[model samples]
Target: MELGSDLNAGEITIAQYLKDVGYQTGMSGKWHIGKEPKAAGFDFSVFFKSNGTYYGRQINDEGIVRKVEEHCDLYCAERSVDFIKEAVKKEAPFFLFHNTQLPHMNGDLIWDARKETKERYEVSEMPVAANRLDDLSGKPEYLKSVRNLSQAKVYGYPDEQAIQKHTRDYYAVITEMDEYLGLLFQTIEDLGLKENTYVFFMSDNGWMLGEHGFTSKVLPYRPSTRVPLFVIGPNLKPLDLDQMVVNIDIAPTILEMAGVLLPDNLHGKSLLPLLKQETVNWRSSFVYEGLGTYGGALPNLTVINKDFRYIETFENGTLEKVIFQEFYDQNNDALEVNNLMGSAAVKSKVGEAQKLINAHKNRILKQ
Candidate 1:
């Protein structure tokens, strides 16, 4: 039922999948995927919207909009924690999907938290990204004029000061989120649900704090593409994994965890093997995609591997036609400051990247 070439456009979600197998599903915070949580089979939902304000937040609860007083993220967390505690009392297993707005800087971009938490970190203390000073020479021209809510204050200032302030606030907001997560985790611990519950933490996307002089996501850059993923549950060893992963795998992983039969058309592989410390042959790389922004920016796709990232940026004017290609040697240039596209030195690796992209396109367009 996934119509597009993008496999991330899922028809059956993890919630729907789990619901079929008998699990109590609940969700809070942003549901950006167009459909409401009920449509996707969640029994209980809250505060779900595409994006908006923090305080005086308008949250949709079973089709009713309730104006909330506290910050949106904290309010959602408190409700989610309460749901977790109450849900376990029932006979069914529960899956509480807790999403927070603390880290999200979209739309008028509320950079807010508790007063003490926001001021806890000094601006100088937060370490800026290595590519924070990127001049945008290799980037598209239209991106320069994107003065929307996410980037107005971020790109309006002088370079270093902008990066410092953005990074400082980012950390500040994350610190507040950490406090909320601590509360949620403690609830799980106290309720004796740690052994049975699997808490998977990840974001839809990562932001660029002046990386390549950009303030928002939607670029093929690592700063925008790479996100922190944490999977915690009983009998799972805690260790760093260098394997390539993506958000697509989340649904399939959940189904696998719940002992459901995997549909053959799934575009993602489960991480259960990896979590059990078993040796499994996993994907060497994957594609990063960004659809054009309301005729403003161009649609771009990148073939990303451990050692290299190759991009094919399409024309904004024509949309379908390729305008330019970029290749980064991620080994030597981890910050992605250098573009080796069409360079004679990396032609062989570039060829491999092209093949990868072609194969991925074929896989995506199977419908």
Candidate 2:
């Protein structure tokens, strides 16, 4: 139930709906769905107090701090397993959003991996992923700040070795999570409810893996918005939705799957038909936004269609003039190494995208 990309307020927090619908909702791992999990309707949560860290996790049991410990993911998985077992005994359907913070960075696991990988890349040598903003040192009032590890000096800058080590460690965590997901699947099967239960596995946002000379998950780049989303359940037919699907659509899709009527106010349309391998008459483009300037305020907007993507960054203080524009033709430069925003033909596409963005924004705000 990593409902929407932004773990922030008012962005289709599905956990709230899960709890409201009488589903025993339990969250293990990052509960970045605003400052209060209990208020958001999570029954039990083992969340991190802050971002970037694995050793010594903070737990909140319905709003109260319960405990903290190292090896957070392992503990979280144990608790989740227990919750599942209990839910089975109670004869109730359970919704567990196991959002892992592990591949996120600044954790004991990272430190361990650094040592394990024998410092392959210098800390400074590695650059942020393309989707993240760089150089936040000047703006004190910025929403977020991006900082490379202090240990970068050891890597002799260009931290290739460090980056490689981090990548390996991140994959290791994913492997561990995959194993847990496998267990979860097994548990569902063992309980004879595999056919009925719906499970979605996806990343909240795409991570910067040394793409575009930047790192992090804030930029309006493809790596950030293009998260991997997959579903395993009874109703959903296996099919890849190659066309653009925004994060906002997820809420309606889940609601539709559970036989719940989608709210008319939601900005997204139900993706149930698409999941069933049915042709859906939907929009060709998706609108995207992320943490604003500083780290969270530098307003960025994007329109991604099946064939092309256009992104615009507004000046920090003034949201009027476009500071930068990037255009990528998926058919031609699939890697997105080249920018076509400057071309005359590309400008026409951007012009169209602007109208699409305006329409989406108006529709959502009106709702």
Candidate 3:
């Protein structure tokens, strides 16, 4: 799991599993694991390295590396549409892993949003986060170091004007990405595949647009940890479910949908039952672990449930020394502005959160 390292040979990726089950697999956009998508079981791919440039980035089309003139998100979408058309021509089931880099910061700010899209939003109209100027007094001390090292520092601590501009550009890039997604969705409907194809809309992580005076995703705050996850497919109810889920669930869900057996080693449960509106027991709590990828933030394990979130910060990557702890009542403080770890109200629940964290660690150790 080192940076730029190849995916382990034994890892059974979703693409590999789908291809094994006779489905055509294609990938477009970021493939930073190492080597290329082909080694990871993608039959066809147009990919680039980590956080590719929005314009004129080098792309590897099936093995031919070349610079593309158009925006990377748009290019990736078009290539994915091409893959879908090819698969339809062959009358084959296909899985296209299309990744987009839109809305992600390019350097200290968002800079590559299309001109027309960028103009749609006025900076003066953008709303800044309430905690944009937080001094980090109530939170973990490491967050102060993170704020100093993060993009907010590069942007000169982000005054009101700077924050508004960043937010405006963020919205613009997202709108651009939405238009690109429309192209894919329209293609699917036009090809008569709308009834069968499953389109999952999700993000790898959420960004901090001046949230708690931070500008990146390394912190374990709600703004950084929470992300959108929705599935579109045939016969699935449109209603929302309140149960919590994690990214690991994606693999098993897709496997079940394809009628492929779920591997016993997979830790996440399939969400197909929930999607079908079936009554079933679901997870009440989920754990979030951050390994301090940015070096300024401390490693931490957080237990998040409907009632509260408990975070235990460690001293280093070893995760041995518990240096700090935080507890927040989710129902009362949805924004997680208040830390209640030292309060008597959460003393009893602290043990419960620790037990959950221990259970997760034991499960990982067994795996």
Candidate 4:
């Protein structure tokens, strides 16, 4: 149940809570929360690394390894389907984390369900959070200061034809995921379990095929930080939450959804009240820190407050360099082009944000 990255990226830790709740918890595909699956506390697990083909492979569950003959998509989906069948047969509330490797990258597998045409894939439109060119339209000076401006240069777009081809493969994976999701949803509906089952669909983080002259998700840009979130259930209303919600909020949301009491030690906020349309005050700022050993030695610390984002990059003992410090009036420049951090008018605001980030770190330490 432990995904490699954040809880939102994959259903890693959420799966752990499911097992803790006495549900028949099972996970298949990329349990990357830690080097060992047992560390995350899962009854059944399938772990994979970050490289190579993400499909037609094997997953290690407990101490035993299980071979999957099908592509990665089918491999995970089928296992989840079987879990659901078993759960229904046993009248047990099952928790199945069917994490997939599709629509992520290194496209070798071709999935018809995920893509239809070259154009759909060429633009990388299949991703819910594709990089928008409009975001970089302004701030010519900032763009110039940053290295690697071309899409082809940044995200390895390859040739025009190659990008189109890659896009096709990417879309195929997305479509395949969408189809499997529909199938899973249908199963619950057909079994008359719609009222009880809650389905949450989201990407771990935004994947960048091109936009912003960037490729992967290590950056603090919206294309990487923003994730698509949707919860569908019988009584849930369709709502778009503009309020800032970080990946940390997910753990508590799932815990609350399962009708479990919030563990006081957890660092996430439950979205149960939000789901019920209760006007509860939520976290206004999202603190982002890409610290730890992953994503190379390029470390970054960013804080996104009401209308400003302060990004500090460091290497070894070098002083912190303000790679990107901007304040965008969400009501106006939502794309975040204005670098108000450099302006004298916003010095006080910038100082306040720094204090907030410092306080946040202190709170985490005290916890």
Candidate 5:
């Protein structure tokens, strides 16, 4: 889908809003939001719009385009530590957003990791996803398109052979990233910021290692959308909540932690209550939107709740026709091999999913 122009100060970012409340803000990581981090009111920032290289990445600091030869994860960790040491000297509250660009596709369309890390996960040791050998007969036509299968074809990712070759590399990248994070964690403990900082960990999206015989994201499948979420803070016990959470909730959760007022127009609510182990009413499902054109899957909407996965494919937004519908009983079909849409007993369940889609459309009209 098309996005608006670059973000400006007219609309305050989370970093900018935090700065207004006397908190020094800084960020170091990948930012593809169509605006410079400095323009968003970050006190100090360092990033290079790299073309998928792990070393010799270019950086346009101010107006100077310079290059650095550090591994991306190491480079980011160094910068984050630098900012933390500086913030400690200032003797005030600070917000640091340390993002990493790892376990993501590189020039070869596969995740890149250190050679040693990759060697640790032998191809024979890799575990293929449950739906690695899925046949797309029950899925929409768009999912079976050659264009959408580009990544999968690059490494035989449509089956277990693909998982053996690619998933190991992906895990290696993540494990290397985890090592660098240990450095950041040490910095936090060394600087005594552990108690005050509430670290939130999440991914932009999940990946599919041959899930449903497909690779890459933008599908209505569980492996394509179920990202990991982790929260760590002082005095906070680990409790996994069953509520549906999305990336949009990150801002509201952070704002609530920083005591900032939430903007009413936000699409997600703060997860702070749930994080605190509070018994509160929460959403049962979330809408997974997939908007695409050439080289991507067809436009679609999916609602994944506690017990079901419902998908509706569209004709690329022209509203010419709905290709079809799919429903999977999560409780009985964790692998999503069974399409429950045609079941006679679950007519009401199908209707409920349709209602969610209709409600979202009505909300858009009101906006």
Candidate 6:
């Protein structure tokens, strides 16, 4: 589906399910999925369309469009806190989708981070990505062409200075976002809701910060696909997990936590067992697909595990006509600088990966 387009009416959202089960739902910031948050089951909404400007912009306050002069993140945080406060006063279980637009580029190579936050970092001290300088000659032809022609090449192929500036602004905006989030966290704590509330932090997608000479996502590489997932709540121990998990798992997990029955149509398993640190059978590998959102990126399907990532690029978004393949031994080549597709040792593994991919396709079709 396109950005700003309505989601399929036949599909049910987690918000709709929760609202049916007696939860007050509110959303703030970045509601790009067409119509308004109310249509998606949010009872209270203060949202903006698409990627909003960091400065003055229009916000939809429960169907009223008004100009917000403050940074969008701050406005979102304040509104989220207010939602929580109101929900608490009503003695209702609440779900606040407090989204933000921080760190995402406002325009081509333009970052609108707060001046104080941006000044905290010195450009000279910013560490460049290890693969930023790669020429992409050994990689896919599509990536090479993208590096040469995309808007990322406007200031030339991301020299140390350019990469440093990007990193600095990126880090600064994230820090500013964290500062704003602290207010909501403090409000929750002050209201004695920290023990009862689950705070899940995650990103929709990871960005390519000069990795493989690319600046955007939509590639089937670690830098473009991998993102952080953090879950904080009552009785959850602090520990790291190596098991593979997908974004789909989040919905089932939340439903399980809220004592709702898992829908048969749900494609993901509940992560409650994993969160409790119980030994459980988990996925060893999962399929990752990219539909070429950025310029020159081919539609690709990939199987990624802790040990390796195998990608098959297609001729177009229809995903027909396999044009190129890439295999990376992630154990040793974390940066994916070397392609292992031609190696004799990985020949058998390639067949195994294809089998896994086909199995995933069948499962998706069944769903």
Q: Give all candidates' CA lDDT scores.
A: 0.77, 0.63, 0.84, 0.61, 0.78, 0.84
Model 6, runs deviating above 4 Å = 147-149, 362-367
Q: lDDT tens digits, residues 239-278, model 2?
A: 6777667777877888777666677767778777777787
Error of 5 at 42 (Å): 1.2
Candidates 5 and 6 compared by TM-score, better number: 6
**Tens-digit per-residue lDDT, 1-367, candidate 1:** 2222222455677788888888989998876655677877788888556566777888887578889878788788887887787778886788878788768764676575567875887877766666655666775666667653235354554357666766777788888788878888999889888898899999877877766656667677887789999999989998899999988898788889899999997888999999998999999988876655542557777988899999987876433577888888989998888888768999998888878776766665664
Better of 4 and 5 by TM-score: 5
Better of 2 and 6 by lDDT: 6
The reply for model 1, stretches above 4 Å from the true place, is 1-10, 146-158, 317-319, 363-367
lDDT of 4 by residue, 41-105 (tens): 55555555553355556666556676655666666666666668878888988776666776665
Tens-place lDDT digits, model 5, residues 100-174: 778676655667777888889888888887776677777777666745476677677666766787888888989
Which sequence of candidate numbers ranks them by TM-score, best first? 6, 3, 5, 1, 2, 4
List clash counts for every candidate, in order: 0, 23, 0, 14, 0, 0
Model 6, residue 139: C-alpha shift (Å) = 2.4
Sorting all predicted structures by lDDT, with the top scorer first, yields: 6, 3, 5, 1, 2, 4
Cα-based TM-score, every candidate: 0.91, 0.79, 0.95, 0.78, 0.93, 0.95
TM-score of 4: 0.78
Q: Where's the lowest-lDDT run of ten residues in candidate 3? A: 103-112
Model 6: residue 91 alpha-carbon error in angstroms: 0.4
**323 Cα displacement, candidate 1 (Å):** 0.4
Q: Any idea what lDDT model 1 has?
A: 0.77
How far off is residue 77 in model 6, in Å? 1.1
| Candidate 6 per-residue lDDT over residues 193-278, each given as its tens digit | 97899998998888777776677677788977999999999999999988899999999999999998999988899989999999
